[model samples]
Target: MASGNRPVLTVTGLKKSYRSAGEDIAVLRGVNLAVAAGESVALTGESGSGKSTLLHLIAGLDAADVGEIILDGVSLSELGDAGRAALRRDRLGLVFQQFNLIPSLTVADNLTFQSRIARRHDPKWQEELVERLGLARLLKRYPEQLSGGQQQRVAIGRALAPKPLLLLADEPTGNLDEDTADEVLALARDLVARTGCGFLLVTHSARLAATLDRQINLHAGVIA
Candidate 1:
């Protein structure tokens, strides 16, 4: 783990709401959290508990109605749409339950896609990711040619290739079986540590949540 006291992510009094059938629905209210460098934090919440909403807000995919999100010393509210998009591309790594690997690209190309676009590709680091993720042998294979776990591993490698300041994953292992979920998550945690990047993982499985360095629950639109 990288030795640093400063947090890679900080959320303060974060709030968001939406209109539903003419009624206002609050998803997150006064939610405050932080993730330090090299730390892995698990976010567990019941369905519709705003877990995905918070993640979307953090990733700049959606805007928060109120509150503040500071990522790697930059505030989300300060950036415009294009700036936020650039930040997401350059400073944040995201993974979802679906293995969104490019079907036409080989594993090698898929792994380096994000980094290359971000202009932060490091050959040595990419090589290390290939070796660490056990993707060396599958480099020439396409996504369709790999198993679910293998494809997820490639997704993870793609996310980490740029060494972003923080990694946000939403139900990243939801589509996998127990053993495969555990294996993929273990690789993610190890790689997050290796990169010294803060990790915030949203998971429904309490068993999986307990494996992280810290765990937090969201309930009734607040951190409970």
Candidate 2:
């Protein structure tokens, strides 16, 4: 890792590959990225340019076949699956394009899910999250009872309630209408900024990417 109060996340020569039908498939090669504390960065790419792969690697949801990933001072290459899982639970938060809320859980329960996993539930924090995410009224309702926008808001609240060191978002607005997407992204950006955590969001929309602190493109397995 690089020294002295720099970025919370850094990558050098990050690579991922797979084998199918006796052929080697390289998804990402020699990608480099850096996201500092409280900074929002967008990863933009055409379909299959490896934007999602990069985010997964950074989040430790998937492994790199080779290369280095350092997040919040720890190298991902050095951690085992169990170690990485713990790190993700304790220090990372994720938002997916699909709002993966549990079907049976109420809004209140879903928002505090991470806290339960980490054994660190704070009722007050969850309450604050409910209000901030505009989920107070919906707290008693289930996922099926909410609209796409409301569901996404709950997803954001769940991710943010953990106070993670880094937040990874993968096409978070892909399913929403333009106005709703903008609104959800706006709330997400605002909360992440207020919490002072590093954020890396993947999107194909130039307009959305433009709203971030910095924007970079991925092309042919490399960051541009």
Candidate 3:
């Protein structure tokens, strides 16, 4: 729909497969994708179209049977597990539908975990984020102490704290009520824009995808 040449991520001939019931199931077949820096893109699909699989592959959480994934000019396939983990820790930000916050940590700790792991923790930026994400008052509260919406906000704060090269969101609003989902999604949009980070969102809602710069649907693992 729109055009840009920033090129933060690129994919070519991507493939993934799994074996089940003594049969080989091919989830992705030579998929190709490109995302520019500072852009927001929506990835949508129906049930079992391999949307999550693609997101996982792009995030370096899963391996591809073939092809390549290049992030910020570095090919992910070339990195070992430790290297990939480091890349994910340092250069990538991830937000999921479940809001995977650690139960033992307080809001502040959860928010700063990624940054600490990546060795990019900026105190000034963290404070601004606490206020901007509306997390200032909840800093001492743990994940169990917050509501679904509040917890999701904390998760978003954690992902953004690291200030990674790219943000990967998988059904980020799936667990919240419509109004709350709207609020969290809005916050995500605002922060991603403010930081000029690239976003690749996997969602089932066409309504949500419409707000992004481009919408690409995954069908049988191929972008349609």
Candidate 4:
């Protein structure tokens, strides 16, 4: 690891580009980052600065043009598609701006969905998350019945339920009002601390970044 300590995640000389209008546009250029076990880091940058690209790369949703990603001491470059998929399923948790909840499932079911899929579901942890997220009252309701903030809480709950080693959040508060966003983030940080999981949060909110333990700013496809 970069710090000589075992980091939950580390990225080295990462690069990524996309083809647009018949020309290649670079999104990430020689980017490097790390998140220690149980530490929280905020990733901030303006639009098109590749904040989300870094998260996608770390999550193994997209491949980099060069460099390496190490998660929980495992190199992503060595993993095949199936291995990547398994890693994501068993060791990673994601919270996106979209709050990708199943519309058919009730709040209770949605909260436990990822954990069940990972086969690491703990009834006690699920109950605690439900209480912490203030979702106990909405358990029987479906996603369509909940407001945007409520759905987001459910999403956070789902991500944390599995107690994964690493959590990647991409603008998880994008759709909420400032106050609600703060509340949700508070819950997330608390749960992450409690679970002893490392967090890499991507956000445009400086105020939100301030709440984290450390902050990393990305500019022109590189850490600034």
Q: CA lDDT of each candidate?
A: 0.94, 0.89, 0.89, 0.93
lDDT of 3: 0.89
Q: Evaluate residue 99 in candidate 1 and report its C-alpha lDDT on the 0 to 100 scale.
A: 82
Clash count per candidate:
0, 0, 0, 0
Which should have the higher TM-score, number 2 or number 3? 3
- For lDDT, candidate 1 versus 3, the one ahead is 1
Give me the displacement of residue 206 in model 4, in angstroms.
0.6
lDDT of 4 by residue, 1-224 (tens): 22443589889999999999999999999999888888889999999899998998899988999999998889999998899998998899999999999999999999989999999999999989988999989999999999989999999899999999999999999999999999999999999999988999999999999999899999999999
Candidate 2 runs further than 4 Å off = 1-5
Residue 160 accuracy (lDDT) in model 3:
86
Error of 2 at 181 (Å): 0.4
What does candidate 2's lDDT look like per residue over 1-224, in tens digits?
Answer: 12343698989898888898999989898898888888898999999999988888888889998789998789998999998999999888899999999999999899999978987777887777787788878989999999999999999989888888888999999999999999999999999888888889999999999999889999999987
- RMSD after Cα superposition, model 3: 1.2
Task: Give lDDT tens digits, candidate 3, residues 24-129.
Answer: 9999988998888778999998999998999899888899999999999899999988888988998899999888999999998999999998899999989988
The true-structure Cα RMSD of candidate 1 reads 1.5
Model 1, 1-224: lDDT tens digits are 22466898999999999999999999998899999998999999999999999999999999999999999889999999999999999999999999899899999999999999999999999999999999989999999999989999999999999999999999999999999999999999999999989999999999999999999999999999
The TM-scores of all predictions, comma-separated, are: 0.97, 0.95, 0.97, 0.97
Q: Global CA lDDT of candidate 4, please? A: 0.93
Q: Cα deviation in Å at residue 13, candidate 1?
A: 0.8
